[model samples]
Structures are given as structure tokens and as C-alpha cells.
Target: MAEEKESAEAMISEIHKQITDAFDVFDHEFNKTVDVREVGTIIRSLSCCPSEGELHDLLAEIEEEEPTGYIRFEKFLPTMTKVLMERRYRPIPEDVLLQAFEVLDQEKKGHLEPEELTKYMSEEGEPFTQEEMEEMLSAAVDPDKNVILYKDYVGMMTVEDN
Candidate 1:
């Protein structure tokens, strides 16, 4: 509801702030003409995005927009937009993930039993399939405890953007 909306807004705002700060840093470091290699370096330093293997692809994509061999801050804006739109590159907010976890962990025992999580996600909300729930649990939950720790869930869902 309102809380979810607020959390989403806060996450978007934080991402925007991070991108703006990166722009400022780039402007100060490179005098308005950044190359593909520089873009890779800067982005790698800024966030865990555009993995090393994806750098070439990112450069190619950016070149389509800028056409020029170098990218100024103005040109960089579109690249940032593209990066933000990419789920693999985008960073979800920990607070938002925690809020969702809280919704699932009604008892607030600091961990969610697999059944509780699976039932909620597969029946109460948007309804993920049984397979999807199993996959998610296998990847993020503790097999021994048969539960998911909030910290582990947060780590799996989001990355440190700063």
C-alpha cells in the first residue's frame, strides 16, 4: 500500500542520487570526453554493474546513442538510464526488501520457514509458481534450518551501490 509505494519511491530516489553523484565525479575526473574503456572503469568503480564481460556490449549500446567515440556527461546520462533500466544492473533497496520480508515473516522471528514463504508468495500475493518458489528458496534459504534469514535474503536480492 502506501508503505510499499513510499519504499519504492525512496529506492528510486537513492538510485537517482547515486547516478547524479557518479556524473559529478566523472565530470571532475575526465574533461567531458570519456571513452568506452573509461565508461567500463568508472561504472565498475561506481557499482557492481556492467560485468567485465558486458563492458563491450555496454560500449556498443552507448555508441549507438552518442555515435561519437567519446562520451560527455550529457551522453553519459542516456547510458545511465539504460543501466538503471536493466534489472541485472539495478540495485534494489535493502529497506524495501526487508519490508517485503516482514510481510512474509508475520511472526517476526528473524527467519521465515520455507512453507510460510512459499505459501505466501505462491498464494497471497502476485502468485509465483511452485517451481519458482522452490528455485528461490534453494538459492536463498538455509537448507539446514529450512528457513530464510532476512540478511541472507537482502544480500541475494540487492547489492551495495555506493
Candidate 2:
């Protein structure tokens, strides 16, 4: 079950990335004004990864005329920490994710911004596509934002748990 969920999330993240990339082509760096064809080509991106910030960032970028490159977070990240801590999947120290959340949250408000979430995303932009980006996030970006919280820094977490 966990594996399947992770796989799906990953798929979604991949699709989301693609969409963001397409958005960037015309919005971020382009000479001509925005067009519908460019926009139409990006709907296919899915959200396989669990990074809510990325989705928010992409959506915000689309909404704005200027390039923001990121989005703000709500109360979801700390929430994801809790979900990830649930032992049903495979319990871990929880501290690792919590610590990460703290650093990312910065303000200690239990939320993260889109730029903060980028650390978890893949740095390599190879094989980029809206569909592909969506696929990666489905597993990576927990939309509910309840994975890790309320603990010190942990050394590691089982892949199965993640």
C-alpha cells in the first residue's frame, strides 16, 4: 500500500514539474506575450509527489503576471509530519522530518513556503515535462501536509515509511 501510494505521488510530482516548466517557457523567459497554446499544453502535469509548496508555487506563478517562482504554505507541512509518523506504514524517529520542517518553516510557524519546499524536490531538470513533473510529486508532496512534526533531528527514516 505504501509503495503504491509513493509511486502515485511521485507520478503526480513529475507531471506538476512539467506544467511548471511549460509555464516558465513563456512566463519566466519569453519574448512574446502569453498565448493559449502554451497554456493548453500544460494541463497534463500530474501531482505524484507530496510537495504542496511546489503545486502552490506553480499555481501562483500561473495566476500572476510577474514571475514569483514560489508559493507560500499554510498549515499543511507540519500536518504531513504527523501522518508520516504514523506507525502503520513504518514508524521512524519523526525528528528528522520535524527538524527539516523547522528549518524550512524558518519563522517556526509550522508552515513552509514554496521556496522552502524546493529542497525536497529533485535538482536535476532533465527529462522535463508537465506530465513528468506531476508524476514525481504525487508521492513526494503530501497535500494534507501531515508527515513530520514535534521532534528533534533524526538520522534517517525507512524508505518504506517515506
Best by lDDT: 1
Residue 87 in model 2: shift from native, Å? 17
Model 2 over residues 1-162: C-alpha lDDT tens digits? Answer: 999999978865654455445445655435323443333233322112323344445344444366443222222222223323332223333565566557766677755434344444445433345554456344344466633332311323223332
lDDT of 2 at 110: 52
**What is the alpha-carbon lDDT for the whole of candidate 1?**
0.70
Leading candidate by TM-score: 1
